[model samples]
Target chain A: EAEVAQSPRYKITEKSQAVAFWCDPISGHATLYWYRQILGQGPELLVQFQDESVVDDSQLPKDRFSAERLKGVDSTLKIQPAELGDSAMYLCASSFGFNYGYTFGSGTRLTVV
Target chain B: EDKVVQSPLSLVVHEGDTVTLNCSYEVTNFRSLLWYKQEKKAPTFLFMLTSSGIEKKSGRLSSILDKKELSSILNITATQTGDSAIYLCAGATAGTALIFGKGTTLSVSS
Candidate 1:
């Protein structure tokens, strides 16, 4: 079974430092999503992309966070000047279409000191 | 604001016990409901329910969706220690991202 791929399973950095996470969705998937899961809360959507084009980023904190999928394949999420509250598990998922089931990546756990 | 809610924030069960997790949603346009199991990292898909009345089952796990009630239930029978994890429920609307609930943390002891 094909699975979504993520890099740097764990990352720890000091506050105000920059951090980036990478994700490669299942091959041929057209839609990709990035989510942040807090320690005791459910995962919240940060952004959604359709073929490299951002579809929804209403919840993304653009002032400090940025994401890109130039080729509509792999994606990268960066947080500039990370804050202590930014500590969480970052998950990525993808689907062939809006109605299809999604496959998730192992996720990158971020720890800000 | 669309959202999903799960009940019994936590559960404790022993091996051979049956457990039921609940999920409810309040979305403008309902498309599908999905359940996932999160151990330590990412969540793994368990079920996707799009229709009402029809139950989806896999091995010892089963799920059913009720569109009218805006709720779903996941049942795990003959639980084992490996069943300990956080179970997530998510709902999606037409052409929109999935919204997740807080999840239920289930601890299946020996």
Candidate 2:
């Protein structure tokens, strides 16, 4: 089975530092999603991309977070001046279309000091 | 706002026991319901429920969606230690991202 790929399996950064995570969705998947999972809680959507265009980012903290998928295949999410509260497991997922089951990557665990 | 809620935040069962997980949702234009199992890292897809009154099953696991009640249930029979994990439930919207519930943590001990 094809799996979504994510980089930086673990990361620890100081507050005020910049960090970025990358994800490569399964081939042929057109919808990619970025989600943040806090300890003891479920994953929350940070952003959603359809091909190369952003479909929804209502919950994303625009002031400090930004994501882009230039080629509509791989995506990058960056957080500038990371804060302690930003520490969480960042998960990437992709699907072939609406209502399709999503496949999640291994995820990047971020720890801010 | 779209939301999914799960009950019994945590559960403990012995091997061979049967467990049931509950999920309720209040999402606009609800498209589908999804179940996933998380063990340390990310969540792995388990089931996708799209039609009411239809049950989806795999091995010892089964799930049913009730659109009329806006709820779903996941059943795991003959559970083993390996079945211990955080089970997440999510509600997918028609044109937006999925909204996940807090999840139910199940620990099956042998």
Write one digit per residue (lDDT tens) for candidate 1, span A1-113. 89999998999999999999999999999999999999999999999999989999999999999999999999999999899999999999999975577899999999999
> For model 2, what is the alpha-carbon lDDT of residue A57?
93
Model 1 chain A worst lDDT window (10 residues) = A95-104
TM-score of chain A of each: 0.98, 0.99
Q: For model 1, which pairs clash?
A: none
DockQ of 1: 0.83
lDDT string, candidate 2, A3-50, tens digits: 999999999999999999999999999999999999999999999999
- Per-residue CA lDDT of model 2 for B1-110, tens digit only, reads 78899989999999999999999999999888999999998899999888653579999999999988999999999999999999999998898478999999999988
| CAPRI-style grade of the A/B interface in model 1 | high
Q: Give TM per candidate.
A: 0.97, 0.98
B31 Cα displacement, candidate 2 (Å): 0.6
**DockQ of candidate 2 relative to the true structure:** 0.85
lDDT of 2 at A61: 99
